[model samples]
Target: MASTIRVRATSSGETTEVQVLIQHPMDSGFVKDAKGETIPPHFIRELTFEYDGKNVFIADWGAAVSKDPYVKFSFKGGKKGDDLKISWIDNKGETDTTTAKIQ
Candidate 1:
């Protein structure tokens, strides 16, 4: 299956900039469909980024987050060609993970 995560990491000698985009419904349980039924809450509960076995960034999200969320952050001490691991778990227990190389 295709990964639902898309990420990019770039190193600038001293820091690495990371950007991520995730595909998700992110229903807040307040909106209604055409039939006027409330949408159930479904959102990413946690997101994490790791480099060199150390976590550099983490996000605790809720249903208030918009769909297909985009995040950007920078961290110190990443080298070119090194790996950055990204993962997320949703409220439904669904998960996806991917690794991106610092460029």
Candidate 2:
């Protein structure tokens, strides 16, 4: 499946607030499909947020997490023009990444 990410960043004085929405099925492998077969687990294992090539925030997730997870965080020293990158790796070894400029 193709995953999509949306990121928004806004600065307040010296701090920048960041929020993101990641698209994924986040299946726990316990749910049965319409055909009565278990849907194998497919969830994001790790998510990282980087600012200016430096890690600012990271999350370790599992099947328990909800689909299309939303994460919000903040960091210092980020301005409007700084580069923000977000990426995720799922349990199925699938990965996707996206970048945005802080607004």
Candidate 3:
């Protein structure tokens, strides 16, 4: 199954606040099993957000991030009906994308 992503945006005056929820198993390679085997670290490393084809935000994360990570961010210049596209890449080379429209 693929990761689940949700986006929400609220506009007040001339600014838009966006919140994103991404469901993923951010595995950190620091745990050992009963057999004493090392676990591999796998997590989302980068996220990019664009508003109507213009770069709006970018985030770089590490293993310290939690599983099923959720991020809340806001930007200006977005208006009602504008499209917000978000894309992310994990340490394991997996990629996912989602979109939301300003309202």
> Who wins the lDDT comparison?
1
C-alpha-based local distance difference test score of model 1: 0.94
Ranking by TM-score: 1, 2, 3
Better of 2 and 3 by lDDT: 2
Clashes in candidate 3: how many? 1
For 11-97, candidate 1 gives per-residue lDDT tens digits of 999999999999999999999999999988999999999999999999999998999999999998899999999999999999999
Model 1 residue 48 CA deviation in Å: 0.4
Q: Between candidates 1 and 3, which one is better according to lDDT?
A: 1
Where in model 1 is the C-alpha error above 4 Å?
none
Structure candidate 2, residue pairs in collision = none
Candidate 1: residue pairs that collide: none
Q: lDDT values of the candidates?
A: 0.94, 0.89, 0.86
TM-scores for all candidates?
0.97, 0.93, 0.88
Ranking by lDDT: 1, 2, 3
Clashes of 1: 0
Model 3 spans with C-alpha error above 4 angstroms: 1-3
- Model 1 TM-score? 0.97
